[model samples]
Each structure stands twice: as structure tokens, then as C-alpha cells.
Target: MKNRSTELREALEEMIAVGTLSPGQHLDETELAARFEVSRTPIREALIQLASMGVVVIRPRRGAIVAELGPQQLVEMFEVMSELEATCGRLAARRMTVEEQQALQAAHQACKEALDSQGPDDYYYRNEAFHEAIYAGSHNQFLIEQARSLYRRLRPYRRLQLRVRNRLSNSYAEHDGVVQAIISGDGDKAAELLREHVMIQGQRFSDLMASLPQLGKQAA
Candidate 1:
């Protein structure tokens, strides 16, 4: 049952990422169940999970609808995300154990492999693990929970960001800077690199809109 829910959630998230399931569109459980050859039980469970992640809105009587964040809202969220990640990076640089640092290096290597040998979709999944390692390395339970909550809300949009042209290579290079700063125990440098990495600004924001036209249209 857990696997079924997770599978449905991933499939739905991919559809959302690619704009097949546009924001604000109602999710018909019956149709989804038929399409996936599954029971409504799994579909409902998946929608519930998506709701918790901010991917869908579950209404009292109207059922589930794909979530839509306006441009301003998205920018606001990104701003907060940047600060949270910077904090994680700073703490991780100072607090991570030798084993944790080794794990982080392993995650970074996996991200490098994904960038070289896989498509944007594969890179997106690896990126999640890469960021997760930093979050765990922070070794601060309260900060970890806070970062995890925001991370879940931003996951789908962040996944779509990888579709931007040449983003995989560019992001990998940026990750290298972050890893170096963290490895050297330079908290301030790690914080700065992480902030810049997560904060979408100017041209980067433009690229994001170009990559995801649905967001552009919605924000317009």
C-alpha cells in the first residue's frame, strides 16, 4: 500500500512537472485509477500525500486540485528557502562529523554521475539527495524539520527548474563550490555559496519562466 501511494505520487508529480497536469485543474481520481490500472484507494492516498507537499489542494467538499503559486508567492518562498539552506550549510560546515562529511561527498559524486549519464529527470532526483545530505549534516533537529517542510513544498517546482537549458552542468559546478566551502569548514563561505545557489535572481528567474511556460502564463 505504501509503495502504491508513493508510485502514484511520483507519476503525478512528473505530470505536474511537465505541465500535463496544469495548476488549478481538478484531479479526477476515477480517471487516474483507470489510467494507472489501480484502485481509487491508492489514488486518494496519493492525492493526500501530494496535498501535504503543497502540490495539490484538498478541499472540504470539492476534492483535490493542482496547486498554483503566483509569481510573487513563488519568489517569496524562494527567498525563505535561500535563508534556510544557507543556515543549513553554515551549520553543516561547522557541525558535520567526519562520517557525515564523507556521506556528503558520496552524495555529491552521485549527483555528478547523474548529471553526466542521465537526463534532467534523473538529475532532479539526485539533486534532492544532494541537498538532503546537507540538511542532515546540519545536525540541528529544529532546523532540519523546518528545512524539510519547505523542501517538500518546493520539490515539484525545483524539479522543473532542471529543465532549463544547460542547468544540469551549471548546477553541478555550483555544487562543487558549495562542497568545497563546506569541506574546508568555512561556514561563511558555505553559507554564501548556498544562498547564491538557491536564490533565483534576475537572469536565472527569467530562465525558470522560460523553462516552465505554465508558470509564466499563470503568473502573467
Candidate 2:
């Protein structure tokens, strides 16, 4: 079972990701505690965790507020995430053990099941497992830590991207290409596929921002 703080954090993050909590909006501890049927301590802890993830800001006097990321900032962060994932994919192609490969296949299967079931929430959970398997398969501890750190920071935004119309099917297709390349030990292909898979660019970025209009706002 999840801890109170973690569950509250996830709920708040989802609300922010789906635009229920707009960027820069104030987070009232009393209101949230009442709404979630929790005490102020858990709310404070969740807000602190969100602050560390760059999802919320904790000011000395003003308390907590949502953190805004403009499109350019989001693009830059995605670029870094793409490169990190590409490195992991490239290394995994060459270094993954047989057991790791089996695990990756299992994760992919789970993702496929979720996709076939047409549950966005389920797919998202399986998708994270699939990517984490690839990261672990790389056998590079430092790279895994870096990728995971960035991944945690970007989780909400990435989850929001999945809410785009028909994005789940498109994402699953991309995952197929990536999985095949990695399993075949095609380092270059795996790297390229993984890079493209995680990096939302050009028209895709524009469309995502348009779909979630709250995400594209300029910092005030």
C-alpha cells in the first residue's frame, strides 16, 4: 500500500498534469487537506516532494505554488531526456545479459497487454516499467541514476502527453521498433529509436501544447 504522502503527491501531481491545478496557482494546505481527507502534515510533505521534483515551488512567505514550464523549457528538458535514454538504449544493446533481455521482453508484454486493454492509466504504469527495464539493462549505474532522476522530474509532463488523442497507439508502435532494435543488438538503431520515442518535437510538441493549453504558458 502507498503511504499517505505518496498517495497525496500522486493525486496532486495528476491534478497539475491534467490542468486542474494551473501553473503558478497557489496550493492551500488547509483546502487540500480537507479535500483529500488528510492532515496538514501529509499535505506539507507532498508539497515538499513536489517542490523537489520541480512541479511546485515553496517560497518562504507565500508557501507552495505550481511551477510553470514554458514550451522552450519543456523542449530543452525533453532533449536531455532523449539523449539520456538513447545512451541507455545504445549500451543495453551491447551489454544486456540474457536475463535482462528476458525482463525487457516481459515488460514489453505487459505494455502490450495494457495497450490492448485500452486503459491509459494501465499503459502508463507498464510503460514506465518497460523503460526502467531498458535503463537497468544498460548496466551503467551512473547513467541509470541520471536517467531516472530526470525521469522523475518529467513524469507528470510525460504522463500528460499520453492523454493526447491516439498517442497511446502511436507510442506503442514506437516502443515496438525500439524493443526490436535493442533485442537484435543493433546499437545505432536502438539509440535512434529510443531518442525519437522520448523526444516530442516540432509538430508533436505544438500539438501537445495545444491539447494541454495550461502547459504552454509564459512564466509570469
Candidate 3:
């Protein structure tokens, strides 16, 4: 079972991610404690954890507030994320075991099923698993750790991006190409495909920027 602080941290993280708590909004320990039926200690702990994750900022006198990333900062992070994923794809194509390859294929199929029947929210979970499989297939511990860390930090933005028009379908199509390249043992091809698949550019970048305000208004 999870500890009270851990549970609160995850709850708060989800609230922030779904925009029930908007960026730059204050987080009051007393209010959170009352809302979650917990004490101030746990709420403080939760806020501290979020601060460490860059999801919250703890000021000396102003308590805690949700952290905001500028467009340029967001884009830079995505660029790094794309390169990490591309490297993982390249290495996995050369290094994945038969079992790992099968796992990746299974994950891809699960994403397809979710896309067909369950909509973007459900597909997002499967999509995460599909990427995890590739990260593991690379068999590079340091790379995997770095990828997972950045992936977690960028989770909310990634989830939001899928809500863009036709993005879900386009994402799955890109996954198909990536999977094919990796399974065919073509490292260079897989790297290129994965980089393109993960990069946010041109129209996608515009769409994401346009959607940011909507996310802020979601809880209003």
C-alpha cells in the first residue's frame, strides 16, 4: 500500500495534469488537507515532492504554486525527449531479444485496439506502454532511466497533444512505421522514424500552443 504522502502527491499531480489545478495557481496546504481529509503534514510533503518533480514551485513566503513552462522551454524538452527515444529505437533494433521484440509488437497491438474503441484517453495509456517496451528493448539502463524521467515530467503535455485534431490517428500511424523499422532490424531507419514520430514541429507545435489556454480554462 502507498503511504499517505505518496498518495497525496499522486492525487495532486493528477489534478495538475488534468488542469483541475492550473499553472501559477496557488496550492494552500490547509485547503488541500481539508479537501483530501488529511493533515497539513502530508499535504506539505506532497507539495515538496511535486516541487522536486518541477510540477510545483515552493516560494519562501508564498507557499506552493503550479510551475509553468514557456513555449521555448517546452519545445527544448521535447527535442531532447525525441533524441532519447530515437537513440533507444536505434539501439533496440540492434539489441532487442526475441521476447522483447514480441513485447513491443504486443504493445503496438494494444494501442491499436485502444485507438479503435476506447478513444484518446485509453489509447494514451497503451501508447505509454508501447514506448516503454522500446525503452526496455534498448537494454541501456542509463538511457532508460533518463528517458523515463523526462517522459514522466512531460506526461501532461503529451496527453494534451493527443487531443489535437487527427493527432491520435497520426500518432498510431507513426508508431506503425517505427515498429516496422525496429522489427526489421534496421537501426538507422528506426532512429529516423522514431525521431520524426516524437518531434513536435510546424503544425503540431502550433496546435499545442493554441490548446494551452483551453487547458487552463478546463477547471474554471
Best by lDDT: 3
lDDT values, one for every candidate: 0.86, 0.87, 0.91
lDDT of 1 by residue, 38-111 (tens): 99999999999989888899998888999987777878898999999999999999999999999999989989
Candidate 2 residue spans exceeding 4 A from truth: 1-11, 14-22, 214-220
Q: Each candidate's root-mean-square deviation in Å?
A: 3.5, 3.8, 1.6
Model 3 regions lying over 4 Å from their true place: none
Q: Per-residue lDDT for 119-174 in model 3, tens only?
A: 88788889999999999999999999999888877877888898898888899999
| lDDT agreement of model 1 with the native | 0.86
Clash number by candidate, in order: 0, 0, 0
lDDT of 2: 0.87
Please list all clashing residue pairs in model 3, or write none if there are none.
Answer: none
TM-score of each: 0.85, 0.85, 0.93
